[model samples]
Target chain A: QKEVEQDPGPLSVPEGAIVSLNCTYSNSAFQYFMWYRQYSRKGPELLMYTYSSGNKEDGRFTAQVDKSSKYISLFIRDSQPSDSATYLCAMRGNSGTYKYIFGTGTRLKVLA
Target chain B: EPEVTQTPSHQVTQMGQEVILRCVPISNHLYFYWYRQILGQKVEFLVSFYNNEISEKSEIFDDQFSVERPDGSNFTLKIRSTKLEDSAMYFCASREVGTGANEQYFGPGTRLTVT
Candidate 1:
């Protein structure tokens, strides 16, 4: 099985709607979870970061990790057209190295 | 806020030719990394550098690939002999410290096309 799996969603939602993106992983050692936003032809930018399980909120975005289920999620509240982009979920083990494993990413569109 | 910067936003080269992608990480960052994303594929880690040496590298990082911190500010990834499969977007990332908890900042990336 792939170490990390994410729906390659071209998920479209209306402006002001709530958007939830998720990823599942097989590695139980992964301790740090991150969400990145990437526009077409642009680099991935850090959107939200969380360590271990629980919920982390930053502005309109919230990141949740369920280590027991090996699942992670990023939720965008009050989505806007400016929020349209591919969301990539990345994770790394607790080792003191920066090696990261990434999901295929989900494409999201927030319609105006 | 400091950000990583990559140069030659796009590059096209002939197969078997050597190509080097350059990046300037955040000045205070102590860890550097290289990752690549092939067309329609997930981003994959290539290698990580800290304390002037490789901390870890994925299997995809073969002997043909090499990374260097040639100067105080610049980090580079060199593909000795490019293959068509080498065509992908290469990203440079850096973190303030070599810790699993620190957030990494990524550069825009360099799109390499090996024909």
Candidate 2:
């Protein structure tokens, strides 16, 4: 199985709607999970990061990790057209190595 | 706010030619990384550097790929012999130690086209 898996969603939502992006992983050793936003042809911009399990909130974005399930999620509240971009889920182990495994990003389009 | 920066945003080269992609990471960052994304694919880790040495590298980072911190401010990735399959967007990222170490700041990226 792929180490990390994410739905390659071209998920469209209306402005002011809630958007949820998720990823699943098979590596139980992964301890740090991150969410990045990438515009077309641009690099991945760090949005949210969380260590271990539980929830972390920053402004309109929230990140949740369920270690037992090996699932991670990024929730965007009051989504805007500015949030239209690809969302990438990345994670690394606590083994002192900085190598990150990434999932196929989900494309999001927020209509105005 | 300081950010990572890369030069030659777009490069086109013939197969078998060598090409070096350059990046200037955030000045205070201690860790540097190189990653590549093929069109419509996930970003794949190439290598990570710290203290002027490679700390870790993925399997995809083979004999043809090399990374260097040639100077205090500049880090570079060199593909010794480019192949058509090498065409992709390469991103440079850096992370600082201590607080917020998990956050990696990425550069805009260099699009390499091998023909």
Candidate 3:
């Protein structure tokens, strides 16, 4: 089984809607959770990062991690057309190696 | 604001040829990394370097691939003999230390098209 799994969602939503993207993992040793945004032909850029299990808020984006359930989520409030992109979730074990395991990104399109 | 920067936004090379992708990580950053993304695929980690040595590498980072911090500021990834599968976007990343945080800043990436 893949260590990290995410729905490759070509999800489309209208503007001003609340968007929730999620990923589930099969490993319990993962302690660092991160969300990245990637545009077409560009590299993945770090959006939000959380250590262990907790809720982290950064303006329009909120990242939550549940280590017990091995689940992580990113919520976007008031989604906009400019927010359309692929969101990838990545995590690494607490071993401090910093080698990340990434999920298959979900594509999102917020239409105006 | 400092950010990771990569050169040669796009490269097209023949198979079996050697190619070197260069990156200038943020000043004062202690950790550097190389990741790649194939067409319509997830970004995969290749290797991580710290203190002038490889800290970790994935299986895909085999004998053909090598990374070096040739200078205090420049980090590079050299593919000894490029394969058809080597066509992908190579991204460079760097993270600062001593802040009790490890969030990497990625470059725009160099699209390597192996012909």
Which candidate number has the best lDDT?
2
Candidate 1's DockQ is 0.89
Report the C-alpha lDDT of model 1 over A46-102, residue by residue, as the tens digit.
Answer: 998899999999999999999999999999999999999999999988875857889
DockQ of each: 0.89, 0.85, 0.81
lDDT order, best first, reads 2, 1, 3
Q: Candidate 2 lDDT, tens digit per residue, A1-112?
A: 9999999989999999999999999999999999999999999999988999999999999999999999999999999999999999999987664678999999999999
TM-score of each prediction? 0.97, 0.98, 0.97
How big is the positional error of residue A66 in model 3, measured in Å on the Cα after superposition? 1.4
Docking level of model 3 = high
The native-contact fraction of candidate 3 is: 0.80
- TM-score (0 to 1) for chain A, all models? 0.98, 0.98, 0.97
RMSD of each: 1.1, 1.0, 1.0
Q: How are the candidates ranked when ordered by DockQ, highest leading?
A: 1, 2, 3
Worst 10 residues of 2 chain B by lDDT: B96-105
